[model samples]
Target: MIHSALEFLTQELNSFIKLKVGDPITNRVVLSSVTNEQGIAIPDQSLGLSLINIEEERTSKDQQNRFINAVGKVEKRNPDIQLNLYVLITANFQNRLPNNSSDDYVEGLKQLSYAVAFFQSKSVFTQENSPSLAGFDGDLKKIFVELYSYSFEQLYNFWSVVGAKYLPSVLYKVRTIRVQENAIQQSGDPIEKIYLESRHKP
Candidate 1:
């Protein structure tokens, strides 16, 4: 589910960016890590969407293990785990052109701004609004995106930990992707009564 959600986001953003720019760049946005295992930059002249962190959404934690099925049988399953994902959108562009050296840098910022605009226009995504999401086989109904800000020190620490130089980037918090197992732990008939009558005197 996590992978599906991120992939969906990357595709949608790429489409929007292409529509705005019309630069004939195939896959201007992609789901990728900023650096590889060797700590080398992986993407250039493109927007990289990377999962930076995952935090459980404790408030939505399910406590009930039992639920009634459509056939009226009681079934027990473990509580689902809800998670919020922190993703980083980074733009990597270099001065590759001798005549238009600044074009890459300027285009990087342009692409990044379009990304922010796309999210701002629509912060929430649902199957109704985003029909492409229906292609994924799951009950992931909706997702919310919000801008996440960081202090200067926090940003420095993050870049240091990732072993990469800072580029034009933005952080967003994606809310509430659910993880659940389909297997039922237990099953039983529904309880109809709490007590039974004693007919004889003790």
Candidate 2:
């Protein structure tokens, strides 16, 4: 196998997953993406790649940069294949109060999405830090913690309300990569393929 073998091992992995792991639900395998294993291919690290470089409850840009730096370190260690990263953060982190304005709320979400696209292979997830644009689920007094059991749920609802008030055009951008030339040209596609015919049965 070539040094850049993982660059095209999706086909092999697809068959393996079908036989061993079954179809994945939340995240899908990036067809053109691969890792640095010798003859065998590896799955994208989503199963293992989790929320890392997380700060002690901070959501400032500085904290975001810290995670970006972590991604850089992973790249240096695995130069042959790029590492997939997903930065996880909550909106309205308990510590920092976001600017009070509908526009600011929308702007923040747009910024985070842009950051994800720019940080390819390195995406960020924000489930906790959503700004409560519509105000606390009902006044901050009522028998709370009942309807919204967790703060996370409240945050989710908050962002939902904000989006309803004014949705931002935060389009997600996906990139496609190809091999300049496969080292195993004689071996056919780095990924394997199933055969087909007209028709057949017992």
Candidate 3:
């Protein structure tokens, strides 16, 4: 078990609202009664995925394949290490409001959430609402955060399957990470308590 699982998040997030970090290096954290900088319930860390930009970099399909291949080669050399990508956007724009176009600072995070979902082959244009993870016995709130975050990964928005959910296309703030599977895989990973629903479950 990771020392962080039982130490950091558990000790820090015992109250109603808190940003608990069980395993910082693994990106596994907990959010209870807590709101993000945007006043949104951040939930658990898995939902707080680091976004990885999918913009047109002219990497050429072959070059892109090479990059992925390199990642796989490293993973093969170190089975304990799990590599991942994240995206982060740093622009401030305004959406027209009654008074004026107000800028949402947390827009970066939100946009990134949309991006990851889109890359997974999902689109939000069909409706103003977001999609659900089909009750996958995990931190629904964190997953919800993911649903609400990200950026547009490609053109001609579409939907698809990723990890274990159907996602929509959008924009986002991204990043990349590598961790040992034996450590925390997500916010509420096993040996840790990032699962908010579990705490409230009947």
**CA lDDT, candidate 2, residue 48:** 13
The residue-by-residue lDDT of candidate 3 on 1-202, one tens digit each, is 1222212222222221122223234422232222234532333222322233333212222221111232233112223222222222122222323434222334434543433434355321111232222122122212111223533553223223122222212333211122333232223212333555535556
Off by over 4 Å in 2: 1-86, 89-99, 102-104, 120-202
Distance (Å) between predicted and true CA of 39, model 3? 22
Each model's TM-score? 0.91, 0.17, 0.19
Candidate 3 Cα lDDT to native: 0.27
Best by TM-score: 1
TM-score, predicted candidate 2 vs. hidden true structure = 0.17
User: lDDT tens string, model 1, 153-198?
Assistant: 9999999998888888999999988888768999999998899777
In candidate 3, stretches whose alpha carbon ends up further than 4 angstroms from where it belongs are 1-50, 53-78, 82-84, 90-92, 104-176, 183-202
Higher-ranked by TM-score: 1 or 3: 1
lDDT of each: 0.87, 0.26, 0.27
Of the two candidates 2 and 3, the one with more favorable lDDT, higher being better, is: 3
lDDT of 2 by residue, 14-121 (tens): 333333335554322232211123411213122111121112212221211111233233111111221221122212111124554422545345333433333343
